[model samples]
Target: MTPSTWSPAQPPAWFEQARHLAAVRRYQLAEELTRRELAQNPRSPLAFVVLSMLLWQQARYDEAEAAARDALAVQPTYDEAFYFLALSCASQGRSAEARAAIHTAIELDPASAKYYALRSRFELEWHYAAQSRATAEEGLRVEPTNLECLHRRLLALRQLSETSLAEETARNMLALDPECAPAHLALGELLLSQADYVTAEAYFRAALRQQPGLAAARQGLSESWKQRYWLSRRLARLDAWVARAGQWLTARGLGGHLVLLLGFVLVVPVVCLPLCLAYGWSYLRWRLAPAILLVRGRPLGQPCWQCWYRLICPAWRWPWGCWRPTASGARYGASRRPNQSAIT
Candidate 1:
């Protein structure tokens, strides 16, 4: 027998228990309860939406998508179902489908700032930075103080390299909620990108103090700590080439990997041999520079420590020499020299 459709003004007792269980993350009990609810009210769109939410939380995007579609089947005009459908599609990297579903949700509920905020998030992921900003702006217009919309706008600004605007947005967030961890986090990330480790670390620490569970803040703090050491900073700068090379290789797919393998095994040594013969002595000489300075009982200047970069990396000029990339393919400005006081 089809469960009689009644006014869902009062949720069933099991629905309340299931929500509580889900809130506390006892998903198995919650799912069991939800299934029981389904058994009693199999035609309930809300039950399917709840199930979709639970499945989405568990990272079961395919199942969540199906549950959301089931909800839509029960109620063609279910905006909530469309929202979950968009979330599941986005999680599965179906950005176009996600956008389409979210657009439908917005049409169904034009005044929903929540849907707009979510749509802005996926727009950013899809690399529509300008569109994301506009979506976020519209969401803010709908509800001026929506924190999620503000966060999305801040991120879109950051992606567009509008540092001043991003900072302004972050500060506005802090003004609205002084203890917002994500606000602190956004500022910390911006500072980190600008190589202001001290300020970045302070902001990251502040974020962690507010939200002890913020993994991004912890990671930023760790990176700030790592960048404090000279060797670590130089190694990171040196590895920038590796990251670029990996991107180039990735773009070319398997062919680039094959070339890389062949070059490393057969061509690199051949091409490097001549340079090695010429600079092999110089490398050994600098390799022993610290020892030489120590033996001479003279203070080791910065050059003694950093000559390796100058010799091997053509782009690494004298610290603070400041070169820019030219049409000739020269590039510069990866790392900076340590402060004289810090060096001392």
Candidate 2:
């Protein structure tokens, strides 16, 4: 049909296809189709609105806002076009412009629960908890069971520190959808803030069981385990300290020396004492044989003096050797050798 003959009653096939593709999230194909439709009917305001929405979904905010303005130029009363412009403006951090645009959209279509929900979310993003709560309540008044409004209300209450009310809202959401990950996570966070790690962990685990890839639930679960036991918390801190200390030592080339020192100090005491005693007794038996024969031409059972000296000396040396700064002294000596050579 000719452009002049076209009307909403006989919408183009391409426009229908574009809308369908957009609904199915096939944005690229839908965008191509919408542009083709717009090329044939430049004056079609709905086509411009659809193109704006397509651009908005693609995160081309400036282009989407321009396209939305074009839609408004063609049909000044298009509420959906204003809504798209608001969303585009919001994406670009134009909060005042977004609020004005969304207000215009709501004035054009006051009964739209989705618009109310969107406005409520915008308020929440802008940190206007009171306004967000009011907007969400307005939406709920219109549609009592709207999930978007319900979630927004829950978030606004939490932001306002209305803990009991937020918990009630969360429970209501769970009552509506038992497998809702956000509801479970909300309850978990509430409990966690109260230091009820055991109960919080259960809710966080439930959220994960419902939705395994939920990052908030995963983080909450990890935190729950860390704070669940005193020992775990202390160990976690110690591990963090050790990691930082290792990094600090490695930067100064002392990491390897520190490891060796710790092994010698802690491990040698436990292991070397037994091995040293065994070696001392064997060596004394062999050494005393020659000494006894030389002294009286008799076979010696054992030499107590040699045994005591060998055992005591090695044990003494083990700790004294560890205490001595052999590694540090070598590092110091090597560092000074170059300077000493230069001076000589």
Candidate 3:
């Protein structure tokens, strides 16, 4: 159909539905509808950018990169295209490229909070936790109450091992949004790490209250309980072992235990001696010998017993064995000797 024949209403129906699906995080259906819209209007940069965002959300980084690039090719200054391209690059550990693309995006729209948010995410992935915090701080300066920027800064602090700062950030995040499960979880982790088990348990319980399916908080609580239990058990076992070893040393006497220890030490080496010798012999004959011969520019498969032995141990020299004369040496010798006798 011609561009004129495809009414604005037709594009809006698919685009609006796709956008709604994307809003609810139903990326798969959003992607399908966006593709359908693009089929109708192949040159639609908006459709391509939407599809790229959906692909990125689904963690299909390569496809998202391609789609985002296509969108940028159609509209070089498209902010959304650059944003998704940066996200695709960041997800795949291409931090330098992602940063460059995000810089371009920020240049296109300096006031865009999303561009700064994505840059912060890129810094976090690149192991520049300090830079991530700075980026998030910049975003907060631009949009004072941006929850995303606040969350990013909190996570960056946590990664940098600044637990006290992370706890404060988490409290701020919870004050802003009481149902923030991630903030509660972060607070719990900080508290647990500081050995404040009572407060940590309460935070973990509150996190679960906010989001019943908060697996990470549940797992952290479970693991913390397990670790405390195991720590006490391990200490008890260590104490028992020390007591038993001391009693044994005293009752058996140092000389008797020393003799038994010596015997135990000697037995391992005695058992390993034959295997070690065999391995050393094989290593020298196959690997070291052939390598030395190759270094000396000698034909590795020369008509020598050692070369033949090396050939038999093909694990050392593969194609070298293929050219070994040992297999045909007897025939060559017989042929040469007969010809020499006949001439004589």
Candidate 4:
């Protein structure tokens, strides 16, 4: 078909193939197919959108945003293009632009529960917990059983200190999909905060069983182990108390920026001195952790990634700060990115 004579009202076979490949995470092959399709049909907005998705998967956020923009230029009403643009911009730390783009997308496709779910996650990640919860509720209104929205709602609830609601949301998620690692991880975090280390440890272990590479789950497992000891538990309690105090300051209608400022001026002055002394004790304990484990005849605690003993520890299951190993001995993509989503 000639360029001017043809419209991409129906995507070509290659476009479908590329979409399937991208869904299956065969990014390089999907990218190649998408590029070829775009070359043949330069005006195809959907082709550009696929290219944007491919680039985003590769973490080439600038290129991804450009491709999304190209899609928008080709078809001004392409909501998926705007959604991809928002994701790319978010990845690049252009938060305001990303929010605007996502708002456009949501306005264009109000029925798309995924858009609201994504927005909820964006809000939570950016520290707007109340807004995040609202967004998640919007998603749930569109699709009551949406797991993504439920998980984000759970997280937002936790952040807002609505523990009862958060636990109920987590139970709903587990009821929906027992294998959902994110739900398990959230529940584990909740239990950890409540000082229920044994139960939290089980949940963390379940999360890891479902997704071994989940950084947050691994970290939670290590934390649960640390708190099994009385001395470390006391230190952890002190840290949690300080954090709660900061939250109390933040709740008094302080500006978001002032929360940290007041935390430094008010909460930290009273808390951090003792916290620092506790940290000194923590450092000494961290150094002696191996000896303590040996004395207890327990190697269950993961060797601290930063500890000097990690290189020599038999219990070190994975590389430092990584759950997987690559040919280079460091995990590929092992820049310690936050385990944002629990799907591995």
Best by lDDT: 1
Q: Tell me the tens digit of each residue's lDDT in model 3 across 1-344.
A: 11111122345667677767776778788788888888889999988887887887787999999999999899999987888888888789887888899999999988867678778877887788999999999988898677788889998998888877888888888888888888889888888778677778888888999888989899878756754676865886798998998887888897869977998899989989999999999977765554444334444344566544553564534555333455646321122123556678
Q: What is the lDDT of residue 181 in candidate 3?
A: 85
**For candidate 4, lDDT tens digit of each residue in 1-344?**
00112123576788778767766778899899888877888998888887888898888999999999999998888888988899999999999999999999999989888789889989998999999999999999999998888988988988899999999999899999999899899999999989899999999999999999999999999999998899997897799999987787667755765766866799767987899899999987775555454344322343544344443554445433223454756442234444567755
Q: What is the lDDT of candidate 4?
A: 0.81
In order, candidate lDDTs are 0.82, 0.80, 0.77, 0.81
Determine the backbone clash count of candidate 1: 0
Of the two candidates 2 and 3, the one with more favorable lDDT, higher being better, is 2
Please give the distance, in angstroms, between residue 166's alpha carbon in candidate 2 and its true position after superposition. Answer: 0.8
Ranking of candidates on TM-score, top first: 4, 1, 3, 2
- Highest TM-score, which number? 4
After TM-score superposition, what is the CA distance of residue 260 in candidate 1 from its true location, in Å? 20
Q: Is candidate 2 or candidate 4 better by TM-score?
A: 4
Model 1: per-residue Cα lDDT over 1-344, one tens digit each:
00111123678777677677776778878787787789989999989988888888788999999999999999999998999999999999898899899999999988878888999998898889999999999999999998889999999999999999999999999999989899999999999989899999999999999989999999999999998789998899789988999899989999999998998999888989999887998987755554443334422343444444434543333333323344766333323445578878
- TM-score, cand. 1: 0.63
Predicted structure 1: lDDT: 0.82
Winner on TM-score between 3 and 4 is 4
Ten contiguous residues with the weakest lDDT in model 1:
1-10
Q: Between prediction 1 and prediction 4, which has the larger TM-score?
A: 4
